[model samples]
Target: MLKEILVHCGHSFCKQCIQKALGAQQQSKTPYSCPMCKLQLGPILELQKNFQLCSIVEAFLASTSKGQQQPGRLSRGRRAEKGVWG
Candidate 1:
């Protein structure tokens, strides 16, 4: 998702969605618009990748996966049974 993030008129969208929107625009012969702000994006090729947001998302996901893989953490039910706040 973050790997191919695209930005248009200060809004971000995934690459796949942008591609689909571009295709639709092409068929309609209309310009692409930002999904969030509805601002016109002149050209699909001109769309820029938001590398900073991508990097942050990647890091957050990596940390989340690592946390899930660790076996030391107790489940919510078990913690509650042990008198630990759930």
Candidate 2:
């Protein structure tokens, strides 16, 4: 039996046992347990990075800055009325 591990789900099992369990699940409605260790496999931890999400935030800021070129217009004439020297 080949030992296999799924990093995303944090579960390790024998390859043959996993295959047989999958087959049984597909073939009929039956509860299957890990044959080697009998550990109830639950959801695995999904490793997610925030780099892509941060990039999206940065892109939104860039676009907003482009649209804010006319600053006084956005401020509703408040800066102009107050005689603010830009």
Candidate 3:
């Protein structure tokens, strides 16, 4: 059976392929290029998706949108201490 993971390019790659690419990246200083397209994968961390099996398009959007949010951002202050600003 072929175990697969989602690629940043909205494509499916076998788990073996992903591991191989990551190993190549770790062994060498250069980024690992995609086997099929030869596109450099910046970071293996960038390749891992927040959602498993999610389409790359959706995953990319989600990653860009809220990945940088501060933890407890809105809950930092009590309702009585601050009024609604936005």
1-86 per-residue lDDT for model 3 (tens digits): 34557666556676777778778877987776666676766655455542465455565567657755456555325434677443
| Distance from true location, Cα of 54 in model 1, Å | 0.7
Selected candidate, larger TM-score, 1 vs 3: 1
Best-fitting candidate, scored by lDDT = 1
In model 3, the Cα lDDT at residue 47 comes to 56
lDDT of 2 by residue, 8-73 (tens): 233444456566665675467544434455454433322233444546657766876787554445
Off by over 4 Å in 1: 1-4, 68-86
The most accurate candidate by TM-score is 1
Sliding window of 10 residues with minimal summed lDDT for model 2: 41-50
Total clashes for model 2 = 1
Which ranges in model 2 have alpha carbons more than 4 Å from their true place? 29-86
Q: What is the lDDT of residue 10 in candidate 1?
A: 71
